[model samples]
Every structure is written in structure tokens, then in C-alpha cells.
Target: MEFLNHFRNGLVEGEDRDCFEKFLSPHVSMLYKSAIRMCGNPNDAQDLVQETLFCALKSFHQINDPEKSKYWMFSILRNLFLKDIEKTKKRAEIEFDSVCDKLTDRKHPEGDFLRAEVKSNLQEVLGKLDERLKIALVQFYFEGLSYKEISESLNIPIGTVMSRIARAKVYLKRELLRSESMRLEISKYIGDEE
Candidate 1:
């Protein structure tokens, strides 16, 4: 508790610290919940919330309306979350590309064939989707982010995220069905030739 107080004191001073504590401290739980939803993991959520509090402390003087402080903190959290998402995405893409390149350079015919088939199928399905739908589906399904989290991250309404996920699923099912049929037809043709 002593350490916490010392840390708090380091964050702000004078009347500003009093005002900041009165307005912002009450909403710590709400911010933690939001951080959890946005981060999708407890450790990351804790880190995010800590960073958000530090930032809020640094800029507490800029908040003019005490009633709007909640919204202001939310906006700050959202920005931090978005920036983290971008950094993660960039790092993942680079790592993914590097792994793909390494895997492609190795010559294992069966493994290569299986990977190619799966990759082609996924690419075909994803390629047919609109960019917005693709991103929405990836964030919700692949990343396991909740609808509210997706809405906050994408800066869209929750209803819009719902509709996009529905539409993307429909498109994926249709494309997969079509691909399956084509593959079956080709298999039959090759069997007949054999």
C-alpha cells in the first residue's frame, strides 16, 4: 500500500492529483473490463490498463469536463489498443512471411501438396470477401475478440460488426461448397483416366 501511494504520488501532484483521483479512480473497474475485452488476454489487459492510467495521469489537466472524463479515458484506451493492434499485426505479418518463405524452400512433396491445397482453398474464400468483411471476420473469429471489442477496435457500431460477420460467413460457406464440388469433379475425371 505504501508503494502504491508512492507510485500514485509520482503520477501527479497538488490539487490536480486530488481532482484526478476523484474523477478517474472510480472508473478503474470499468477500464479494466474494457481493457480485458480489447486485449483478449488477462496479462495484456493488465499491462494496457496500467499504461492507460499512466497516460491519464500525465494528461489529467487537459480534461475540462469532469462528467466527460470517462469517455475521455475510453478514447485514450481505444487509441492505445489500436496502436498495439497495428504493431502486433505488423510483427505477425513479418514473422508469417519469413516462416512461409522458409517452409517453401524445403522440398517435401506430400507436405507441400497438402499445404498448397489448404492455402489455395483459404485464399480463394478470403479473396472473394470484401476488405471490410474480411477484416471483421478475422478479428472476431480468428482473434477471438468480442463484438463490442471488435466494434471499438474497428471504430464501427456493434450492429455493423454483427452484419459483417454474418455476411462473411455466408460468403465463406458458398465459396467452400463451390470449391468442394470442383475438386470432386476433378477427382472423378482423374479416376476415369486411370
Candidate 2:
């Protein structure tokens, strides 16, 4: 009967709000510190804490075991933090590509031809990506969003994001290697004069 009451009270809508507030409010400082440690910045840590709490509240009804609530909440936070790390990595890759593109298209044309050749090869590789992988990569790397944010924005799973990125890299590697071979042949034809 006591377990039943606890389970029943866990799902109580208005009642749960007060309980959630009382339970979670006391942990805000700890959550924020954990977030900061995971995220490495105060602003991002705050956002992570808020996002974790919001997710917890939205899914609280599904949590029937009050004794396990802390574990469940921490799970949500850990997942978000890991997703944020992947997002940051993707963003860095995208930014590096963007900078390379800009630099290749602008100055540094007369120094080394191998660098230009590599950049062109990479661009060709990028152009060969399928539409879905292309879009996922763009959203993740170019937009600098977490997996959860990308999932919410694109209405796709976090796993799909991971898979798409993996597939994209495979395709890019194949295309880059092929392009490098082609560049070698083309260079022979064009001659290494000027």
C-alpha cells in the first residue's frame, strides 16, 4: 500500500510540480556545478542544467519509482553532456573546412600547389555526399548544435546523427582518395610549369 501510494503520488500532476520543485531546487547548485564541469563554461553549464531539468519534468510521469528518480535525472544530464561534446567536435570540423575553403579560394595561390590540390580534392569529396548525410553534417558541424538540439530541430534521432556522420566520413574518405589519384593524372597532363 505504501509503494502503491508512492507510485500513485509520483504521477500526480499538480502535486508532482510542487514535489519536483522542492526536490530539484535544492540540487540546482550541485547540478550547475556538474554541468560546468562537464561543459567547461558557465553559460553552457546553465543551459545544460536547464535542459536536463526541463526534460526531467516533461518525462516525470513515466518515472514510477521515486527511489530511482535521482538516477534517472542524472542519466538525462550525462546523455546531454555527451551529445554536447559531439556537437562541439562537429562544429570545429565544419569551421576548419570553412576556413580552408575561404583561404583556398582567396590568397596563397602561388606558394604550394599540393595544398590547393588537396583542398580541391576535399571539396569534390564533399560534393559527392548524399543529401541526407550532407544535411545532417551541415546542421551538426556548420550550425554548431547539440545532438538533442539537432534532433529537435530536424525531428530525427540522436543515433541517426551519429550514423550519418560516420557514413559521411566513409564516403568522404573514398572520394578524397579517388580525387587524389585523379589529381596525379591531371597534373601530368597540365605539366608542372608555373
Best by TM-score: 1
Candidate 1 error regions (>4 Å) = 1-13, 90-194
lDDT of each: 0.62, 0.57
* lDDT for model 2: 0.57
Q: Give the CA lDDT, 0 to 100, for residue 89 in model 2.
A: 52
Compared with the true structure, model 2 gives a TM-score of 0.38
Off by over 4 Å in 2: 1-13, 90-194
State in Å the error of residue 5, model 1.
6.6
- At residue 174, candidate 1 shows an lDDT of 60
Per-residue lDDT over 78-113 for candidate 2, one digit per residue giving the tens place of the 0 to 100 score? 578657656665221111345344434335454245
Summarize candidate 1's per-residue lDDT along 1-194 as a digit string, tens digits: 24235546676467756865887777666666666545545667677777887788779878777776776776677678768866765211101222233334235555465445545565655655665676577667655668987776566899999999999977765664566543443343334332
Structural similarity to truth (TM-score) of each candidate? 0.45, 0.38
Q: Worst ten-residue run, lDDT, model 2? A: 90-99
Number of backbone collisions per candidate = 0, 0
